[model samples]
Target: MFGLWAPERPTEAAVRSEIWSLGARHQGRPLEGALAELEADEITSGRAALLRACVAKLRPAKVRR
Candidate 1:
C-alpha cells in the first residue's frame, strides 16, 4: 500500500473511480473479475486509493517482466 491521501473527489465517486481503474489495470490480466468485484462494491474508497497507489508503485515491475 502506497499510503495515498484521502481523495478530493466527493467521497464515494472518487473511491468508485479508483476501484474501477485499479480493477481495469491490475488484479492480473483480463479484468472481468476485477471489474465485477469493483461493481459489486467489494472495494472501499480508502482501499481503492491504497490499491491504486500500490499498482502505480509496482508498475516498474510490470515493465521489467
Candidate 2:
C-alpha cells in the first residue's frame, strides 16, 4: 500500500534493503529510531506497518536460520 498507482507491498528483500539503508543513514542508531525517522518523514500507516512486519519477520528470535 505504498504506491501512487500500483499500491503494492514491498518484498522482504526490499524491506531488508530499506532497513539496511536506513541503518547506514542513521549510523548505528536503533531500528526504533529509524522507524521514528520514517514517521517524522510522514510515512503512511500502512507503510509503517509493513516496515514493522519486516522487522518482526527478521528479528533474531524469529529467524529459523
The TM-score values for the models, in the order shown, are 0.33, 0.51
Model 2, 1-65: lDDT tens per residue? 44576656778787777777766777755376556665667788667766776566546685487
TM-score, cand. 1: 0.33
Give all candidates' CA lDDT scores. Answer: 0.50, 0.66
The ten-residue window of minimal lDDT in model 1 covers 29-38
What RMSD, rounded to one decimal, does every model reach?
10.6, 5.1
Q: Which pairs in model 2 have colliding backbones?
A: none
Residue-wise lDDT of candidate 1 within 1-65, one digit each (tens)?
44366463335555456546755666643244443444555678855554455444434554463
Which 10-residue span in candidate 2 carries the lowest summed lDDT? 29-38
Which candidate comes out best when scored by TM-score? Answer: 2
TM-score, candidate 2, is 0.51
